[model samples]
Target: MRRTFCGSMIALAAMASPLSAESYPDVVSTSHYVPVRDGTRLAMSVYRPAVNTKAIEKPLPVIFVFTPYRGRSKDADGKVTETAMSDNLGLRSLLRAGYVVAVADIRGKGASFGHRRGFQDRTEALDGRDLVEWLAKQPYSDGSVGMVGCSYLGGAAFQVATTAPPSLKAAFIGASDLDKYAFVRNGGITAQFNTRPDEKPEVDLATVPMDEDRDGSMLKAAVAEHAENTPMGPLWYGMPYRDSMSAFTGTKFWEEVGPYTYLDTVKRAGIATYFWGNWRDEPTSQVILSAANLGSRFLAGPGSHCVPPEGFDLPGEIVHFFDHYLKHQDPDYGKLPRATYWVEGLNGTGGYVTSSELPGVRSHPLPWFLSQAGFGAQTSGAQGASTFTVDYDLPPAEYFAFWPRPMTEHGLGFAGGALQHDLKLVGYPVAQLKVSSDNPNADVFVYLDRIRADGTSEVISFGRLKLSHHKLSLAPYETLGLPWHSGFEKDVERPAAGEEVSLSIAMTPVSLVVPAGDRLRFVVAGADPRQRNLTDIKLDPAPRITVVWGGQDGSRVDLPLAN
Candidate 1:
């Protein structure tokens, strides 16, 4: 059913010969604006091999990328504040590989013009199809086109792939969120990361400066909604529950976001895709969703949301993948399995495995019981139940500071005992807790941490659940250690003061190798201002809470192990 390989640049490089810049001619960069069907134009920056790079007599496959986040920007006075790819995506390497690399700003950002919609805008999808068709018709194009981008750019790539554009050949994406609901509000709880703009502080404006003939029309309107939708923008992420929830409740986010992972629609599209996921970055679960829906080749590595591979040639890997798919070349690259991942805690052990499935295992469900004595993950036996108070009315204190501190430091929290032995937690974790509350609903925050003999602790994963929305939902076709909530259709009821109900909380997927001696701790509380990012989001106000740990029969955490 699967194949496995250890992750290493040396292994990936063996699939194909990396392109050498010395063997190619100089590159020529071109900036232009092409009109879409609506008469609006998109700004594209293209890098092509000069005559010296041995441009074949025929057209070549094109790598098209469209992003809302500006890779290029200009100051207020038409000054060139940034060129492009300042983040070092290694675009030049692709140019040397004999592929045309084009980066564009979706309708609203960069040098393009139009009313930019928030996250996954469908109009951008249409714009992407138009761009792909336009590039295919170009004299330089060999009629095939592929798209690449990470994070926001990856979001753009998904937009294009879902359009089912015939000119689009393949997509190489990284760190993108396809499902708006699951991505923005996991299990009906909002994400804190959306509140602020990513740290692209190199330029203040979203639009890059371009020549009058090359850039599109009124660019200021592009940033208008962006400014209103970004950092401190209450409706999307920052203080989401405050005014934005009620204000934008009726808005259709799916329409603006178009088709993405976690939906059946994306599965129908025909596109060869190569994706990348970081164990510590983005939503690792989404990677599983895409691999499941699209049947993609996914590679796992270290890096935050924006980074590619370190020490290895990410661009070179991209070139080999493109050549195999777009050029129809038969190389060992196609022989590799669909997935590859790095092993955690294996210092120089060179632990990398390749398989047909994503990193999370589907076989084992290890439950660590919650007890009165401690957060008992020992698996030996459960103590009694634990009780904690929840005061939604407790005059909000400094919630920001609480996010960075360990759960033990949270004054209103409870922590379980450490692990009984050295454990390796390799996938997303789920907390199946039996809880009761005085109020009709409650907001439960669950956290996972690793503790060493030296007492230094590192938080590995976190999960959130809203009591009213705690009804069980199982996904038959998907798994990454936890089942997805059926949805928030019918709110569940609380246990009339004395009775308790089961709450299955799904934490973000994670990879960790705990030393045989290091222990894992579980933390639970009413609210965590920052589930994953820095923010001041509180619980939905509950007066008191109780966690039932009926010894072996009671509550426990089921952790997915690497083995």
Candidate 2:
């Protein structure tokens, strides 16, 4: 029998579900701790339609999500004294679509027991599997289960899906990193600047007291214990730990369960997966790697780390995907692969279009070699062009701020005001350069931007490469194909005084239609102050950069040609 439901009806149900008074869906509305391996009890919440006495009796497929946030209701004083389920828009959509939705607090947060651990940790996967197994046996569940979430939660979904429990069927992972080292550390270069190492562990934030005098000491002690233990130990310990005790027992968990270290093993598990990400999301590219490795479907859009209407039709698309895969109603589900990208315009007005694949267009290699007079192509061999000594002692370049700051007192201004350029690129662009540095190792920062006729320029995309780790391995390279996988791995050792070397740096994918008068510019530098300020790292003899051209050394840029 076919059942019909309206979006309006779902919205109304979400409002009255006791999850929230907000206009969006508020499906899940309470929390409880579910016990897992080693006596660890994890917190979880369930959101579904209010029982309709007149409704049909068939069971509904279940959608389970596990996040670090607290699942509890708050009082007028902004204090959370009672357990309440999450009320996210995505869950509401799932419930309205007639599915039972469940949200779990992975071990070590909210009402869940155990220590706080990060994504892809074995404990997380175990708890996830246990949760699905438990849910499948429940009367509310239709015996089928799927997982969904973004960022850390998305990563958790990826890990749990690989477990392939009998009841677990599919997953929707967005803005997640399959290769933890590359995505989080950027080739071992950590973003220690942005992340506060001392931040409190992931716990029931609502239950935390605002008055430090009351809760400060307990919070401090908890954080200190988490920091001291670190989650990586149990992960690498393997065997008894892997099969027995919970793997999540502390913070700094990423240090232990490196995603890249176990991707091959995980892929062999063969769980049906739906990988989603955004162009702007730093780690999103990793999803592509997962798709290619597991031969799963990949869906990408334009946005940052989080999914939304703020992004492309992520919530709706996820619902449809889960419906088809988990519910098994649509045989032709998610069979299409469209690379939908947004193009930024000169006037700040842009739209999105879908292409068959990345690097939609093919273009001839355009060589822009480095010379004493800036960048140019080589006409002949070693003798034809001027050879300047490469050193890192060049004047320090300031970071490029994407948005204007309240104080103009900072940052380096672009030459000739903002060099505005409009670009109508259709494919991938690669930058190849040749040169030997006095130092064997150095990081290259490649920035792509659109400059307007007026003095304003916005960075379109960028890519980085660590020179020494250039020996590409097929297995590791496959991981790099993922959107979230940043290829930079290890620092290149300092080069012999005059030995020359060639390097290939990948540029970020960009699809845009610039106004006729705008300009597309590429800036090659050592550090990007806007995104990352390397003011702290001291360089010896400062690395010198030399752009190699086809005729000069074997340097060239490969652009994906338009179909």
Candidate 3:
């Protein structure tokens, strides 16, 4: 018989049964360590509803989550309690949804044995397979298993599934760390939050927290210390790549940290996947949707990285995928879109729309030449003041904050307006320009904004580049509708002084509506001071950057308008 869902995920969040331990009379919560091939045992917590008898009436599917933080920390009362979920995104709703659930601490973290490696080290997939196999052998499990999580947990999910674990059936990944090297390290400037290397676990897992009482204090102290060391708010952005790599990379090699580095390999894993996350999320959900055409579904949210489970219908979606893949139910995958994204701003904005691909986007690239009279998106005219040399006063960090909707609005750089018409844009916008620097090396930040006649401004899109690494990869530009930087290594081309260099910088992908009567604006800043500690880096040539157009040198921005 097909199982009937209790209610919508919205109702599930409001339900009291899973919220309190008193209501979960038949649910069993157990904690233990799961062994891996390396003799490392990961601390694991399992929650399953019990049948009257020792064995369940029928085998059940399992949902496993891998977390970096210690979920269960002992309190002063000596009671082992789940702190992560209970305090963060609780798994109670999943337990109430009638599924066996398991949460494990990645090896070398949270009372688990061994040294914690870099994020999502490829080897964790092996342990993931072992965990899935272990779950399959459990009394209540029927062999089918799925994975789930957001952010770091999502990365773990992606890492394990890419390993092609035998018993793994599906995954629900939210705000996963994919394609971040492009967005995170945009234009050679460090973007978004990077990891804190100094915040290593104070309590050594090698010691093995033997006594629950003693270890609880040690674990609590370690967690507290780690939390203190980790920066909060909008603290990290716009440093050199070396600092980012150094902090994000731990004791292990850097290659293992970014799963996107092996983009092709991960996409080939063949697991039924649901890629869902907020569009405004630092890494951007669009990256996952557009990069691979796999057997997957995309559910994009309009919020930021910290979108709550209920806000994004997280519980409902997870149940839907797990129900179909793990429980063998026929959930309708046909009605799903190649991409379903949300658009904010302007008339009747802020609701999801389905699409064959990125919604309201096409190959209609319209050029807007830079002119003194504003942007000629419809007509081209040379700006009498077209050539503006690098002011050098612009900060490098302001170029990197490309999130929280409408992109980052730091007000750094040059300004121009596309007047008299509303520009509805979706997808990546390309900025091409002929630039020359007084110094041998220069960094440029280009930003686009929406200026309603009232004078209020909101950033629409932005792009950046280091003049040295200006070689564009035509392959990605052809397919993805934006330029792919060849990186600062092999593609380094430092322009000779006063010798103009052509550059095409790709902005972070976006979906927005510029309402009628609003105008489009563009800005160019030599460097953005808004980035974290970019002033420390000895930027070359002292910023005398020049943007020239029309007279011998042409510069323009191609806005991808929804046609």
Q: CA RMSD for every model?
A: 7.0, 8.0, 6.4
- State, as a TM-score between 0 and 1, how close model 3 is to the true structure: 0.79
In order, candidate lDDTs are: 0.62, 0.52, 0.59
| lDDT of predicted model 2 | 0.52
What's the CA RMSD of model 2 in angstroms? 8.0
Point to the candidate with the largest TM-score: 1
Candidate 1 wrong stretches, greater than 4 Å: 1-25, 51-58, 74-90, 197-206, 213-251, 255-269, 347-350, 376-383, 390-405, 411-421, 474-477, 491-499, 531-542
User: What ranges in model 2 sit over 4 Å off?
Assistant: 1-28, 51-58, 72-89, 117-119, 192-195, 201-270, 307-311, 334-339, 343-349, 355-423, 426-428, 476-494, 530-536, 540-551, 554-556
For model 1, residues 1-563, the per-residue Cα lDDT tens digits are 11111112111221223533222334555666789989977777766655543344457778887876664665667765322223234455555566777788777566576655555556678899999999999998999999887777777888778877888888888877656556666666664545443433234244644445434334454444344333223445522221122234345543346244324544554578877877666465676666666777877775556566554557667777787788776467667788877666755333566786676654366776666555555563644666777533333334222123356555233455555555666677888887777765566777777777788986677777777667766553454435566443444444465557778877777665666656677777775545444234443444477777755567778887767
Whole-model lDDT, model 1:
0.62
Backbone-clash count (model 2): 46
Q: How high is the lDDT of residue 34 in model 2? A: 62
Best first by TM-score, ranked: 1, 3, 2
lDDT of 3 at 381: 51
Residue lDDT tens for model 3, 1-563 = 11112222122343322222322224455566667887766777776744331223456778888877665555545565553234133355555556777888776567665554444665566777788889878877888888887777877888787677778888877776554445455666653445333334443322224233344554444333333332321122322331233343342233345454455654565577777666565455334533343445776667667475333455555665676677666556556666676766536555666777654346477787776555665454543333344443443443334352232243223345445555667766788887777776677778777777687876656667888767776442223545677453556677888887888887755677776666776777665554454555536546566677654346778777785
